[model samples]
Target: MSFVIAVDGPAASGKGTVASGLARELGLPHLDSGLLYRAVGRALQVAGGDPDDAAAATETARRLDPHDLEDPALRTREAGEAASRVAVHAGVRAALLDFQHAFAAQEPGAVIDGRDIGTVIAPDAPAKLFVTASPEVRAHRRWLQLKDQGVSLDEILADIALRDERDSARSTAPLVQAKDAVLLDTSEMTIEQAADAARRIVEAARARWETSLKGEASQKG
Candidate 1:
C-alpha cells in the first residue's frame, strides 16, 4: 500500500503550506484537494449556476477537468466562498471523490491537504495532521496574501469566521480532526517553525507505521 499523509484544516490555517513541505520532505506528490472544489465552484459560477443548487454544483463537479485546477481564478476570495458553499452538498463531494482517491493512490506515496482528508478521504493514512490557528492569525495571513486587493483586515476576519461556521456545520464531510490525527496550532508560529514542527510529527508517525508493518510481517512469517 502507498503511504498517504492527510493534512486537514480550515481556511488559511497554514495546512496547505505544511502539506507541501511534507510532500517535498518525503519525496511525494502533493495534492491541494481544496482546488478541486474551488474549480467546481468557479465553473458553476461561469455557467451562471447557483452554488445552492445541489444538482448544478454536482454536475459542475462531474464535468470539472483536471486542468481547471490550474486556473488562477480559483485562488480568489470569491472562489473560496463559492467553494465553501458548493462543498455543502454531498453530491458534489461524491463527484470529486474519485479524483482525490486516484491522486492518493499514486506510486511511492502522496500528500493530500483539505478539510476532510483525514476524516473522510484518507482515514487509513498512516500520518494525519490537523493544522489550525486562531481565526485572527489566519485572517492576518490571508490579508497578507491578498493585501493589495484593498480589503480590510476586519473584513478578512469576518469572512474567515463565516467560512469556519459553514465548513464545520455542514452535514457532509465537515471540517474536523480525526481521532488519530495530531494537532498543530500555528497561531504564534512562523512559516519555517510550523514546517519544521510538521516534519517532526510526520517523522514520528512514519516510524510507528514502519514498526507496525514489520510486526505484521513477523506474525505472518
Candidate 2:
C-alpha cells in the first residue's frame, strides 16, 4: 500500500514524539532522518575528522552503518553542532539521500520525521505534517530535556533561534514545509493530543484514497 507519513518540524517541536507514537499505533517503521546527519557527525567526531571537511564528512556519511545511527551520544549538543555544520555540505547530503528514501519505502508503510521530510525526502508521501511551536515554547521544552543548569535563559533561547536560522537558511534541502502539509502547532497541546491529531489526518487521507480507488474499480467493472 506504500502509505508514507512525512512529519517535519524544527527541534523540540514534538514531531519526534508524535511520529514515534503514531508509528507504534499504525505498525509502521519509523525513520528519524535527522539522525542520519547526527550519525555522520558522531562518526567524524569519533574518527577525529573535521566536520568542516566536506570530503571527510561525505565519506563518513556514506560509510555510516545503522549501528552508527543508534548512538545515544548522537543526541548531545556537540553532535548537534557537528551535524549542523556537515549537513550544509552538498556532498554529505547527497551521500545520505538514498538511505532515507529506502527507509521511507518500506513494506506496508513508513513514517519519516525530520526538518525536510515533507519538503525534500518524501514529497510524494500521501500524508504530510508540519509541526511547530513558538521559539519560547520550543526553547523551554529543549531546556527541560538538556537540563543544563549553568546556561542562561537568553543563551538557550538564542541557541534555539540560531539553529532555526541555520536550518532554514541552508542552501541544500532547507527546512520548509511542503505546501500541502497539515500544520500542527503544538505550542499549547500535549504530545498525546498531537499524536491523536496526526492519526486522524492520516486516517482521513487513507479513507479518501481508498474511496477513490473503489470508485475507479466500480467504474471499470
Judging by lDDT against the true structure, name the best candidate.
1
Estimate, for each residue in 37-152, the C-alpha lDDT of model 1 and write its tens digit: 99989998998999989999999999989999999999888899999999999999999999999998888789999999998888999999999999999999999988887888
User: On a 0 to 1 TM-score scale, where does candidate 1 land against the true structure?
Assistant: 0.98
lDDT of 2 by residue, 130-179 (tens): 99999999888877867764656666688889888988999999989899
How close to the true structure is residue 4 of candidate 2, measured as C-alpha lDDT? 88
lDDT of each: 0.94, 0.87
In terms of TM-score, which candidate is strongest?
Answer: 1
Q: What is the C-alpha RMSD of each candidate to the true structure, in Å?
A: 0.8, 1.7
Question: Cα lDDT of model 1 overall?
Answer: 0.94
Stretches of candidate 1 above 4 Å error? none
Looking at candidate 2, what is the lDDT of residue 201? 88
Q: Would you give me the overall lDDT of model 2?
A: 0.87
| Each prediction's number of clashing residue pairs | 0, 0
